[model samples]
Target: MDYLPLAQALADQLHADGIPEHIASLFRRVPRHAFLPDVMWGDGRTRYDRAEDPDGWMRAAYSDQPLTTQVDDGAEGGPGIATSSSSAPSVMARMLTAARIEPGHRVMEIGTGTGYHAALLCELVGDIRVTTIEIDQEVADRAHSALIAEDYAPELVTADAEKLASIGDGRHHRIIATCQVAEIPEAWLVQLHARGRLITPWAPTPGAPAGVLAVLEDCGGDVQGRFEGSLAFMWARGQRRGGHMVPDVDAVPDRITHADGDPRTLLDGETGLLMSLLVPGWAHGMAMEPGASEPHVWAVSTRCGSWARMHPDGRVEQFGPRRLAEEFAGALTWWRGEGRPTVDDFGLTVTADGCRSVWLREPRAELWTLHAADHDDADDVG
Candidate 1:
């Protein structure tokens, strides 16, 4: 029944990962089970219930992996699709450490989720200094209930994280987002105080499946920081494909344009990271068919109804209004020109004049300013 030993075990992993001792100390104190729901999306995409499997539930609660708490914005239940989850403990350690939370610091957490991290934040910086925002009411209600039950009452606001800084009157010394963001919203910049740090997972594009961690430090209204590491949190619900993404990979192509290029190189690892950053609105994936010589590499546009695929022979096929394969070629050429920069060779800078830019080598001499994601899934939405 005791989870401290389990919590300590998780903390030990964080220590090994080089998470600071103070952060590990807080990880040791918080009981993760209290913040989790009775039912969680478990391994193999199945539900783990406390009543049916109490022992299994405790094991999962204290385990190192993420446990999904909501699916399809909580509209559809069971293990269909995960829209939210308690982040893995190791990631929590890194983000919390990167946040640099200190005494008297006001911290704003963008996505409250189960409030597990918010509770940890409260324990670190005091309840009065923490403000957490959640979009889903049922999820927020549950988190609120849990926090209250534990006697940690930091401000809980149920609203879209993108819209909060608009009405926020107070400045935050530290701002951490659990959700994945495509472009850093202007509001997040407004709420961040000078010398504050805004830590978030900036996905090239995927409703927060996984992406590099950006640790931007505030100087006046502008922020200067680089990608610190990788994180795999759920994307904010509003930013989800129409609020969360569900790609139509197997859908019959509307049209196929024969192109010549090898897109297989851009679908899986570090190079995939580059593809995402270079070409903003498309989601890339791989499907291995049984008895096939090579896996099918696929890319679908999150906007404009475009798709691209590369067969084993290096022949490329593109569908819809845009030639996604050609876009891939351009991106590849750009990356090659840049010396095939790794994810580490990148960083982001937001100027006080309110211009947001992505950079290479350093924050100055801005590389490009990302535009607002075109959520025009009008053709794909059914």
Candidate 2:
């Protein structure tokens, strides 16, 4: 039932991911299993209890993969969606390295899912210098208990991350998030210390399960940065992904047209990610009938209740106040004209006054301004 070797093996695996020496040492010092819940499982709630299956439990507990620890916001689970988890150790190491945390740096983390990363931060810095905020009370309480069990106590607060400014007093040297946010909040920027860094997953729209990780530094009066990696994390509860609005173009006699372009072809790879960027408040989903040859790519905009369906044969159906099909086609065209920049080519600029804009190539060439939260019926340029 010994777990040190297993924990060390996990640390070794993370080290292979190119984590720097100082950061790697911190991860190696903390026992990962100590932060896990009584039961461990995959995305699905398949419990692996340590007492019942010691070998299997230790294996899962130290495998360097995310362990789903809470479901339905910790509402006594019975086949509900997993809401939070301990991020995979490898990804955590990468994020920590990207953060470039220095000794005696004040660190604050959003979404302390299991307090594992917070504990790692405490190991790197000191417990008094670390502050973590979690939205779910039950999840935060569980993480608190786990932290205490390991004799590693950091300040744990249960509150919405959106209210971070009111809760997270004082400047932070480094800020990171365990959850994904649709847009980088102005609150995070205001609280970040001068030259401080904030690393979090930035999803283009609400409810997106996967997004590119952003490593931003406070640049004088603004916070700007670029995308580095991709990971899947739960969306911020208040900012939960829901930008999609189905267009009733067919239900009502609106407009049906044959499009010169196929979305499936245009939005094939990185272009799909670009489409979300070019057009704000819009989401793209693809589906096919049972046993169909190809799927129809649908673009739903919360902006004007507009919708476009690009069929496999390339016919496009559109409806609502705006012509989303044309919007998508145009966006794809502009993106290609820019030499088809990948996600890494993208950057963000958030001014001190809370004005946020995403740019391509450089900040001066501003692309779009992201509102703090998803509001109803915004204009549709997409």
Candidate 3:
């Protein structure tokens, strides 16, 4: 009841976050609660029910924070992993702004989620020009019903969006993926118009400080763009991996060596981002064990199960095949050689043959090839 004022307030906050008034106004028109399920999860995975607490639900709906709409991929409660969510209004605005949506533009959204962003796309572009895709059929059906109930009918497709060859090439004027990918899929590049922009959240490895928002433009057949800012989203279904923690390995050390410095420093600032790209397929974490003198820094590779641990006293212990500690140190040396560039200093290029190349400053400055199979399972950090 009377949720318009709350929507307006949320829109105001979006405007304050640099979202254009015209785009933010869409929130005022479309109520966020209309797309949400009756039972939702908020911060700390706490449950919020519309029937039990109507006012709290309404306030949460209009708030700028994200609400989990589906958990455990629609399975009954097991461990409550958020599979899909209504992204924060501010992030939605930022991605929309990055998209540069215009009236009559053919827009394609990769993940429909709760259909809230799809509704916003309909507002920017006409309803007929919006085509939303959701991999989960149940989620897509629910979104379709919500959109229909709101008198907004757009093309809703329930299928995997990893490779959109079936959607045809040179179709969409703008393509946006609500999920994160390890690398840009070549199909997404092919499906865009000559001047189209593809925006998605990308994280090469778990060592990344944060997931980056990549706003790419197709140059002829090749796609390239700079990492604009930080934006963390859920992993795409095809690219999803298992949990990331210090791997369970042999108790006895295979090899030990002296570290150059505190290995934890590798997790600092842009170093982590650089390490993520260079040391692909590896996840890192730091913790002090019970009855331990100092905390240890651990790095484990998801691809090969290689593990490395650096003690607080600069002693590095490594096992398995890859020598992850050496690779990480080499990456750190390279970062220092390049003047310690930040995330903004990096950009990605995906060629016609699907080769991903991450560059520093400019594409020609310094580049590293990222193999398609080198994705990690670590979540993005702020």
Checking candidate 2 for backbone clashes, the offending pairs are 206-241, 207-241
Cα deviation at 315, candidate 2, in Å, is 3.7
Question: Which tens-of-lDDT digit does each residue in 1-382 have in candidate 2?
Answer: 6877877777776677677777777666888878887787763456888888888887888777778887776666466777888888888888898898888999999998888899999998889999999988888888899899988889998888776665446689898988887666667776689999999888667633247788888999588888785666778887775546544433452677775546565555565666666666666666675676877777776666676777776677777777876776788778778797787888776677655677777877777775545343333322
Arranged by lDDT, best first: 3, 1, 2
lDDT of each: 0.76, 0.75, 0.81
Query: Using Cα atoms with residue i matched to residue i, what is each candidate's TM-score against the true structure?
Result: 0.83, 0.86, 0.88
**How well does model 2 score by local distance difference test?**
0.75
- On lDDT, who's better, 2 or 3? 3
Q: How close is candidate 1 to the true structure, as a TM-score?
A: 0.83
Provide backbone clash counts, one per model.
Answer: 4, 2, 0
**Candidate 3: minimum summed lDDT over ten consecutive residues — where?**
373-382
- Pairs that collide in candidate 3 are none
Tell me how far the alpha carbon of residue 375 in candidate 1 is from the true structure, in angstroms, after superposition: 9.0
lDDT of 3 by residue, 25-99 (tens): 988898899999999988777688999999988889988888999988999966978999999888898999988
